[model samples]
Target: MTPLAWLAIGLLVLVLLAIGLGAWRLRALSHRVGSFECGARRAGAAGAPWVAGIAHYGVGRIDWWRLWSVSIRPARTWSRYDLVIAGREPFVGDGPDTYLVRCRYHGQDFELTMSRAAYEGLASWLEAAPPGRRNVVV
Candidate 1:
């Protein structure tokens, strides 16, 4: 092949390598981005829900959790999120109605960027015993 052709091929390879490296770096960075409002490293996948809380948050704020530990003799209950995870950070407004609470948790901070309406919809799930009542499942 001509010298010019070889040089062009080498330049193209270099460009490809740079692009690949940049992509890899971005992927790693995103993992630390958290959902959005959290500003911390995301511990789980974006769409991965608690499903059944395979693990715990392993956090120190367990004293505040108040799970509905009431045992109904023969009452069946529906499954739903105990925590509201959503929305971005630096919330401009005030009160819980302004943004979304993480609908679920992955034992990390919380999935953010949901919406006020979304948090309201979780009324049933929010019922629970109280906030930060249950111990960290981890």
Candidate 2:
């Protein structure tokens, strides 16, 4: 076979491998309780502070993936132990059904916005600390 033909075949194999790996990663990360449409932002955004993504809640962490990203790794993970629900308010232009929660994780403030159901689940998870321990949410 010509060298060009071999090169094409190698490229095809690499593309297939990438696709398979991406699929596997997405499946593995998505096999959880549920994923909710959410948005996040660092404490210091200028005009508005919302970046869209889907949040997957795991045992002790919440993994956030960007809405358009296909990467397996989470864009951000908020650990339960280091998370504090600072406050909550309705999602201004997003309608009353959607809400936003201000959280402090590892000393950095962030804002997460999600639907009522997702928020309830998050609150439950945060407050579900061990019997003797307590987590405050508002």
Candidate 3:
């Protein structure tokens, strides 16, 4: 084979190695992304806090009994959270019974809705988070 052809093969190998390494790093990082709950199918509220890069949207306070969230794009909200939002866009429900919440974050808008059951679980996890933990995305 020509010297040039060998060089090309070496370059390809390097590129593949880089991509594989990068993916492994990302997976490791996500594993430590932090989940509040143990993710068990329990009778009462018990769920994990959905992690996002946007720190501005997160739980403000977490107590044993209640949680307060300053959600910019709350997929669901609970009275316990004291969820602070501006407007409700449309009637796009998650389903026949569930309601959807469309809100903006970081100059962009997105919508998400959850069932009454899911919301309860989320609230539980958020409230259970220890104190002094700020809701940060990153």
Candidate 4:
């Protein structure tokens, strides 16, 4: 084979290795991060489209990471103290068991679409916050 062919083969091998490593990383993260898949959209933004992501519940906050991105940093985070559930409704066309929850974090509104069980778990997490740590506005 020519040198150019060898270079092409090396590049192909690198790409495959990168994909394998990424898959391994994602699987390990899922196991240790306790993350749940969900869809999110910011409220009041023009043509705000729902983006698929995973939510990782932390000690006093929740971090969101885009599902298809390679970045390790969270795309968004909401403190339990400032997060508030504004409303909930059935997520149209998703299913009966899925719901769309409207929430406010530091006055910024966003929506999360999750399963019924996940929604209940989120509610419980918020309500279980330590006393004096929550700032209930309503």
Put down candidate 1 lDDT per residue, 1-138, tens digits, no spaces. Answer: 999999999999998887776565444433432211111223356555322110111122211111111221211111233343343333343454444233344444553332455333333334443565432231
TM-score of each: 0.27, 0.73, 0.34, 0.83
Instruction: Report lDDT per candidate.
Output: 0.35, 0.79, 0.36, 0.81
* Model 3 misplaced regions, further than 4 Å: 33-101, 112-138
* Position 45, candidate 1: lDDT: 63
In candidate 4, which residue ranges exceed 4 Å CA deviation?
132-138
> If both were scored by TM-score, which would come out higher, candidate 1 or candidate 4?
4
Tens digit of lDDT per residue, candidate 3, span 22-132?
566444433543322211111222243322321112345221111122222332323323432223323332345443334333334443344444344444454455564
**What would the per-residue lDDT of candidate 2 be over residues 63-82, giving only the tens digit for each residue?**
89876556768899878777
TM-score of model 2 (CA atoms): 0.73
TM-score of 4: 0.83
Clash number for each model: 23, 0, 4, 0
CA error at residue 95 for candidate 2, angstroms: 1.2
Model 4, range 1-138, lDDT digits (tens) per residue? 999999999999999888887677566556665577788988766377889888889988888877766677888988888899888889887889999888898878888999988888888888788887554332
Measured with C-alpha atoms, the lDDT of residue 89 in candidate 1 is: 39
Per lDDT, the best of the predicted structures is 4
Give per-model CA RMSD.
15.9, 3.4, 13.1, 2.5
For candidate 1, which ten residues in a row score worst on lDDT? 61-70
